[model samples]
Target: MTITLYNTATRSKQPLEPIEDGKVSMYVCGPTVYDRAHIGNARAVVVFDMLYRLLRHEYGAESVTYVRNFTDVDDKINARAAEEGRPISEITEETTQWFLDDMAAIGALEPNEMPRATAYVPHMVKMIEGLIEKGHAYAAEGHVLFKVRSYADYGKLSGRSVDDMIAGARVEVAPYKEDPMDFVLWKPSDADTPGWDSPWGRGRPGWHIECSAMAYELLGERFDIHGGGNDLTFPHHENEIAQSKCAGHDFANIWMHNEMLQVEGKKMSKSLGNFFTVRDLLDQGVPGEVIRFVMLSTHYRKPMDWTEQKRVEAEKTLVGWYWMTEDAATGEVPAALIDALRSDLNVSKALMEMHLMAKNGDAAGLLSSMTLLGFPAVNQNLSPSLLEKVQRTNAAPDMLDSNSDLQLFQKKLESLRADALVSKDFSALDDLKGKLGAAGVEVRMTKEGVTLSPGPFFAIENLEVLK
Candidate 1:
């Protein structure tokens, strides 16, 4: 199982040949714990998640190492804590849990290791000392700055020259900076801010240094892959590469960056009233599976547009797919589906392969492929009682549950079906179906039984006549 990934640094797709046979290592820049992660943040997560699955599949699960760092120590976190008048630890801890829960809801697997920045403060201080000793960094006014020009190939990762970057970037005009391109390795923190006692002073690390140090400490001097959203490509990744390479570490072998997200063909922004978090979508009755489906509908390298139409189509598609595979047991993952994913994580093409399997009514094959893509044949969002029943029985009949009134009406419908058989008249059954359909219930009549499922527009008010 050969895998090819688009290396952003090289500007071309390359076959993955790990430094060690039968072993692979990768790192992805994780989220800063401040608030609920928006949809844009989720794109990088889903992208890397697919890659992780592919790597684990190719090189046995035990052989692949994946690390995603948490930027727990940040100015945004401090501000959030100040605004809430609570400790910084409380904010980071709560938000970290929220991030994990939301990502899990969308079916993203947890990384092999998640290193928080604050926990690795000693390593960061050590790395900073190395950079200063190597003349790649200097300290002044209780702040340490990376001398950007000290690394001649500073912009190699981003494919920009220093002059061009300085011209384009809004570089700070601090008197402490040796040059406008110099970035902070360490900055002084106020008494109330989150800081660690360092040789320079009591201060926290800059955002870029946190990732560089953590990746080096966790993944070692060099690793196979490094990933993040394209928005981080410029200053964040560029600065990281400069710091790592200057410290004489080879760093990552390949760079992978997923493009940002859009909503309704426009840049998603709160000012535009188009910005939404994953929880917001879930709260609005959009299933997490729907969010994952819409995300994979487009290529990771391309901007993903989240429209209501896409959401509706995704929901319909999943409903149909889950139905097709309901009775199917696990089967072999189609060779073609794996090939599609191996080709630069082309999930859009992989999903198309899944559609072909479904079209041929190969439910077992489709179910197997869906499992590889992290979509379960069964929805995990059912109620507690329904979920227990599903786990015990390995089936969620219609995946529906409701109040006694609705259950009583369903029993009434079942009795009507039984009598209609004897009377040789289905008019009563037909009428009941119509009324239920009007109330936004999907009615399925089978020789075995009648099942009622509520849809997106289900309304209790419309089910009154059945009373």
Candidate 2:
């Protein structure tokens, strides 16, 4: 089945047909390097990371080219530099590194290309010059602004009229603007501000222009998909669409946006005393995989209510899945789960199906299925030392034996069986039955019929009666 994505531009789930056969070019808006990325910001990263993983899994890894850009030369970064009394470059570098570290800790894969606005200044200048030459943009005073009226399709992406944008924009209307709707393509930098000498002036590119330039330079004019948080749907992405289309390029074919993340039913903010960084979540003992599971529990386009209970629930669910597959003697996952993932990355549905498979005693099928969902069953490769530690912590006195190998294997198997029960996998019961029977164990199928015991291994006494 072909993969379908919810395109923000069309407001529909469209089939993801690549421009070039077997290859997909995707760009996700990256963080502005001024402060640590909060959990809201991390949601976008994780959402896109999942998309990237899904795409790579469906297509070959080499077929996907992912680009996420850093807005290093933004007003926010400049303000941060001033606040800290440091050079803007230094501040940008420091903050960018911190952002990378935070994202990595949460298991986000590095993009194929990570471009910084500071490194793409020349490209931005060329694009601005092209816009000016095409009469799509103009230079006024020490600033250059894109003429909103010039692009009749300005509101196509954002659905916001130029008049509405101008009225709502909180920034003071500069006297040099030809129209209030005209957004800055370039602006003059003062002696202390970071700037690059261009045909317009010694100033930096505007926030919107930087993305347009970087995207064009890296992915060409018409790419497959451009993605980011829903908050960027307005002026930012709208401006990019206008600038790129007017620059005589087709630009992106699909625009995908993930919804905002809220904390405890409220918008995550410092004033609410609920603002959280990914680091904060980690420091609070939230597992990285748990964070990922929680983020993916809801569809990407739906706003996620991140509460502590939700996180705890996600962890419990993940631990259960791990336990089910970890116990199979053959250690094979079910194929049904893998098939579910191939259908549209329906992770929630896949998980539900896994429960059904477990109930049906499909151990191999369950293991195979969960593996396709990127949840591999635990195996013997767990470090011996770690296993020893686990044994020391959780082993019952009766479970200890002088033989290290037997003790470790038995303990691991028992833990796996316990986990399977917790995950509601009844297939594990049969495995336990077989193992106990082979070890000369006798099982009485009593009125309750829920327990097993060791008896004469080779004796087949009252087999029919036991059933």
Candidate 3:
């Protein structure tokens, strides 16, 4: 299947044709290791991870080259170290591992190569010297700045003109800068700070230079796809393009950027009192799988809003799916399922297809599709006894007292629901439902019947009165 992706560079959906027939290469801008990855960051993590999986699906697994960099040498890391009275290496190393653990919890695949910025300092220096030689950059007071206007297409990725950018006034105007729009490529570092000796002087590479250098070093001059959050489309990606193209490298052919995430219909901000980290949600007992499901519920190109309602729905759906596929062996993922994912990571559509498969009693198909979507798969078909034991563990403990007790509660609730429909007086029904809800049992009412799926807080003893 020819995988089609939405390219921010072209502003169009284009089919991916790898430079090498069977090999695929992709570079995603990874995190700067200073703090825990927030939900906003998780969106980009899952987005590129989905693309990485899809690329491997279309191209053979071994033929794919995925590189995600670790920005270990950022000012934020330095500041965090100084503020906490710890070594900068300790901060970067700890936060980098935290990033990996959290993303892995949410089902992100590790990239084929994870190169740290500190390791690529020499490569960055070489690239900067070339940019200087090509007249795309210049040295000013021990600092190297990219000549933005020197490359006519500097703002092409962000679709902003240089004149407009200058008029807008976001550029950092420094006495060392020849133009307000000139961005730093290399900045001087003192003895106290992390420093590398270079042609310019003792200095470190700029933020934008890290990805450009790492991508070139790992994936070569040109690669298949480059991805990150929409926030990076501007100065970050735009500068990377200018410098890479100016250095005479082909660079990434397809530029893909996922839109930013939101919380409850608003931009997640600490000032707004809605900021949350991935670890926070996990600590609150939301399964990592559920978080991954909620992320996929919305299309990658659209802004995903994380809500409590979505979390509950995801939990309910996943529990049902896991139970349904308990004894099923792995089957081939449906072709239609793959088509939905291939069409620009249309995850919501793929989710719909998986639901249809489940409803049709295609347990094997359902399991396969879930795994393809990055959900965990059961390595072996679970035995009936083991499945029941697992279900009891997740269900409210009080309700699973005995077989007779289980039947009694289900029969009682089913009777109450039936009466509530006919009497049109759901006062009793509502009360029982509320009681069940309190015990961590979700009450789903359909035209055909009432279904009770135990939630994380379920308790069986609460239903003793029904007996």
Measured by lDDT, the strongest candidate is 1
Q: Give the per-residue lDDT digits (tens) of candidate 2, residues 1-467.
A: 67777777887778889999999999999999999889899888987887787788778889999999999887888788888899887888888898898777666779999999889999989998989999999999889999989999988887777777767777567899878788999999998788999997799889999889999999998899999998999879998999999999898988988889998999988999999888787777676666766776666777888887667555544444444445665444444555555454556556556545544446667666544444434553332332333244332212111123233334545665667769978576567556545433344444443333322111122121223
Give candidate 2 misplaced runs (Cα > 4 Å).
Answer: 166-171, 327-345, 354-467
Could you give candidate 3's per-residue lDDT for residues 1-467 as a string of tens digits?
Answer: 66888999999999989999889999999999999999999999998888888878877789999999999998888888889999999999899999999999888999999999999999999999999998999999999999998998878899999999889876679999999999999999987689999988899999999999999999999999999999999989999999999998999999999988999999999999999999998788677888888898888989888988777767656666776676789999899989988888888878877755654568899888888788876443322333344486554322123334444556777898788779988898788777767644557877776666544323344455544
Off by over 4 Å in 1: 379-467
Candidate no. 2 TM-score: 0.77
- How many backbone clashes are present in model 3? 5
Deviation in Å, model 3, residue 247 alpha carbon: 0.5
- lDDT (Cα, tens digit) per residue for candidate 1, span 114-196: 99999999999999999999999999999999999999888888889999877876877799888988989999988899888
Ranking of models by lDDT: 1, 3, 2
Task: Tell how far residue 1 is off in model 2, in angstroms.
Answer: 0.4
Cα error, candidate 2, residue 71 (Å): 1.1
Residue 83 CA error for candidate 1 (Å)? 0.7
Higher-scoring candidate on TM-score, 2 or 3: 3
